[model samples]
Target: MEVRTPWQALTRPLAYPRSVWPWRSAGYLASSVVTGLPALVVLAVLVLFSVLLVGLPLLLLAGVALGGVERRRLRIAEVAPAADPHRVPDVPGLGAWLRVRAREQATWRELAYAVLHATVLWPLDLLAIAVCLGLPAALLSAPVRLALDRQETKVVKAYLVTSYPQAFAAALLGAVLLLALLYPLAALAGARAALTRALLAPRETELRDRIGEVTRSRARLVDAFEAERRRIERDLHDGAQQRLVALTMTLGLARLDAPPGSPLGDQLAKAHDEAGQVLTELRELIHGIHPQVLADFGLGAALADAADRSAVPVDTDLDLPRLPTAIESAAYFAGCEALANIGKHSGATKARLTARYDPGPARLTLLVQDDGRGGADPDRGSGLTGLADRIAVLDGTLTISSPSGGPTLIRVEIPCPPPSA
Candidate 1:
């Protein structure tokens, strides 16, 4: 029985079953002999060292240690180890190096596998080698005849029956029986190797862990949005709203008590006008935080308003397949931020905003592009960050590109309606 290549310990477990492979037993038996021969030679040498007084105790300890290492390697280093194969990638800094100290948990087991290999592999190999070679030799040797009684010599001369046809039949029978034994034996070896591979091999756990981290990160983003919303509500009610009310009262009292031509009265009126301008700006800032216009007139109206408010001329290409409240809000905010960035950084004189929907998968795309001075940096605290966060909470994506010179583009893609919402 022979095999083409020496399979890695990890791969052996996944090999084709013997029932499906006529040659599997032969190959497996061949492989065992191929691997086990060296293992036995080493084992014999180690045992010899153990017989010497000075080296005896040390050899015994080393043999035991080698056995442990092999078993541990089988369990943890294999391609499909049942447990986590990731040992170093997850940990950072010198902590990864420290993981080696956990050897007692991992190394000992591998050594056991090595020791077991030493004891069992050679026997299996020898059995396969003996049957495979001896049976064929015996069957072929039957054809040769000697003198009177016809003695054949393989060892001490033995009287032999020399009819070529009969000898062929007997040899053929021996070969058949040996082949039959191989069928089940190879299956048994492959199955055993598979078990070892599963227990000792490594698996890719990092990718799954990274996905989990992204999911948690998205959840936190949603929590952050709600927190900011609470903050904005507090600012509007307690600071800006209260100040505007006081300014209005003061201006009204001045107008009622003073003559129109008086310098003092005129000055108070001027002060009132300035206060109104300040209030207007505050109101616009609050609106930027969350547009109430979208709730009243739908996404189209809110988006039109955003385009109208842009410092640069904005061309609108918005046509909706009609969107739900959450999607509408996401699209509105995304457009508003993109336009804001264009006005603030992009030097392009002309810009366009477009929106569209596809119902098959139920999705929407919003594009804001400008041919201005270009070079917009999303990292430098642009309104784009908030827009991205808003879309992400809805399980959407935000992409931006602004090369130096004259063009900047921002695209937001959101699932038509988020599952949770």
Candidate 2:
């Protein structure tokens, strides 16, 4: 598997030594000095003048800014990007932004993390890198040191190397030690990344709120889409359909006025027939776009209308009241698609549709079954997948169970409040 972090890289023991992760880890730890030094200075100044009210706000600003920088630095040890835990201000301008940031728990948590990093964490990070990498590097340079000094050299400032052989031996030992120490170095980097993520990433509750917002936005889009469909349906029904009706009537009258059995009369007759056919198709298109019955009378009447128009016989057991327009529309279209699929592919001679609303749970349930040679697969380019996606936007679910020999069943469950609610 591809490695994304130091821990994953460490899992491949043989590859770890040759890999760049050791150097990456060292860089990640050593770079702490860059951030830590500034943080320590700023924090010290804040503490010195903390008795003044100005220090408190400055400290908050410093912590919030440092948190953003540290989250970016975390990428050196971690491949996956960290999500900012803080929410955007509802309004623009600096005052609004500061008020929102100051009110969030994440801001305080980040401030705590900043304090810890400045006082303790960064120092420990530098110390680990020094012990693991700096010492080995010093030892490895013993041969060069001996050559320069010509008499003696200090090995890691601890042992004396008086001869070239001794220096070479120290270097070999340093090489082995460096390789061995890198495992722990990489492990430490991974731990640091995890801690940074834990402190800076969005909490579970925040994540849930984000997901809920996205769901709500998607639902609004779906509502807008349904509204557009209704608008188009209305335009076609009121504007185009009426105009086509007038054209068809005019052609009929012209056919009657033309010479009997003449060529012009025959052509007029053909044109009139064609106009009537076009009008019929346009009406069907309008109904398919957004059925007037579904909007005016609710899903029950719409389902009955759909069943009446189905190619195969369909029996419906509907116990539905007027539902929210979105739910009713979604359920109606889903049922229509199911019956259409049954007629097109299922080879079903008979089908059944059942729908009801449960007031206790505030849920709506719809089931469509067919006594056909059942091998329906929505993944095989069926319209059901898109319908299912639409239903899911409403926090509803659509499931299908079609075994190979016979009998296909599709169940749809949607949690919705009663229309009164």
Candidate 3:
């Protein structure tokens, strides 16, 4: 079962008190007064002594301690565990941990929260509890006071209760008042918990850092995937390709040595032709996996080769410097996919590929345009979706402009630093 916080409890009218939320709220607020006073005094003394520089670490230590306390107290009102925004120290040592904590915004936020809790928020919490619980308790004691004193009793030191009936009526009114005040107390507690969360929760910078880490992880995965592809291509080219070449050569020699009309000679000829066809297909498959041309001569040459192989006549205007391996691979493959799409789907006779690198911006752009029926949709299994995803891993963009007429254009841009020789 999911536990609801005091704030969430307030939304459910009947369920708030039936659960432990009201008592938790009262306890949460009451404890703040207990914890905040000592923290306030320590913080003040440390701030006064901070000119000596010895107080800096002491103040940070006090704040760290208070942060732990506040997070625990928060669970009294908030069932959800509070997130700790502090990063672990990159180097593992006491000095390193202190240095990292001192630099973090969370440390400063915790300090500020400690100061506010001590100086301001706790007093409000005490006042709220007093009004909600104390006054009601005092009023509810009127019947007992009347019985013990055997005369008139005062309810809440104001209203006089002379008879048993009046004393019981005052007690009943106090009970109703107590019930009414519980809601406000819960609201106050919820607001205090929310304030604590706002101050101590992860900031925008931390979220951005998390996003950057995820992107780096994704880039690593892409690098590993590309490495595996290259390894497979290398194995095929060096091992199986060599064996097939030797086999084809031997069969050719045997066919030439045998007499022309013999059945053995004809069989040798057929076997040789079949072996040659299989070798050609295997080489094409290897190139499609991870082309040797892309690895050897870089993206420009690889793109030119891909364009030459396209069934549609493709004109090329490519100028590039050596780029990071990942960037080169992504750009080359994206270009190849675009050309293949143009050949297979676009009923155009001509296509053009233009590529350029801008060193100032550290960006490479490739544009493939075809004079074909131009209604390319990646959702229709056009093969561009995978290419787009591959390019996106490099923080690159792939765009297509293909209206339902003629002339489709695909553009890809990737950010990459020039490779050092």
Evaluated against the true structure, the overall lDDT of model 3 is: 0.88
The true-versus-predicted C-alpha distance at residue 241 of model 1, in Å, is: 2.6
Better of 2 and 3 by TM-score: 2
The local distance difference test score of each candidate is: 0.62, 0.90, 0.88
For every model in order, what is the number of clashing pairs?
28, 0, 0
lDDT (tens digit, per residue) of candidate 2 on 1-421: 7898999998899999898888889888998889988999999999778888668888888889999999999889888777777777755799999999889887898889899999998999999998998888888999999999999988867799999999999899889989899999999999988898888775664576679789889888988999999999999999999999999999999999999999999999999999999999998899899988999889999998898889999998999999988899999999999999999999999999999999878899999999999999999987999999989989999999999987999999998876773
For 29-144, candidate 3 gives per-residue lDDT tens digits of 99988898888788889988998888888988898889888887788888776767777775589999999999988899888888888899988998999999999888789889
- What 10-residue stretch in candidate 2 is worst by lDDT? 200-209
Cα-based RMSD of the predictions, in order? 21.6, 11.5, 9.2
The numbered model that scores best in TM-score is 2
TM-score for each model: 0.44, 0.61, 0.56
Residue 74's lDDT within candidate 2 is 88
Which candidate, 2 or 3, would have the higher lDDT against the true structure?
Answer: 2
lDDT, residue 291, candidate 1: 64
User: TM-score of predicted model 1?
Assistant: 0.44
CA displacement after TM-score superposition, residue 379 of candidate 2 (Å): 29
What TM-score does candidate 2 reach?
0.61
lDDT of 3 at 270: 98
Give the C-alpha miss distance for residue 163 in model 3, angstroms: 49
Off by over 4 Å in 2: 202-250, 258-421
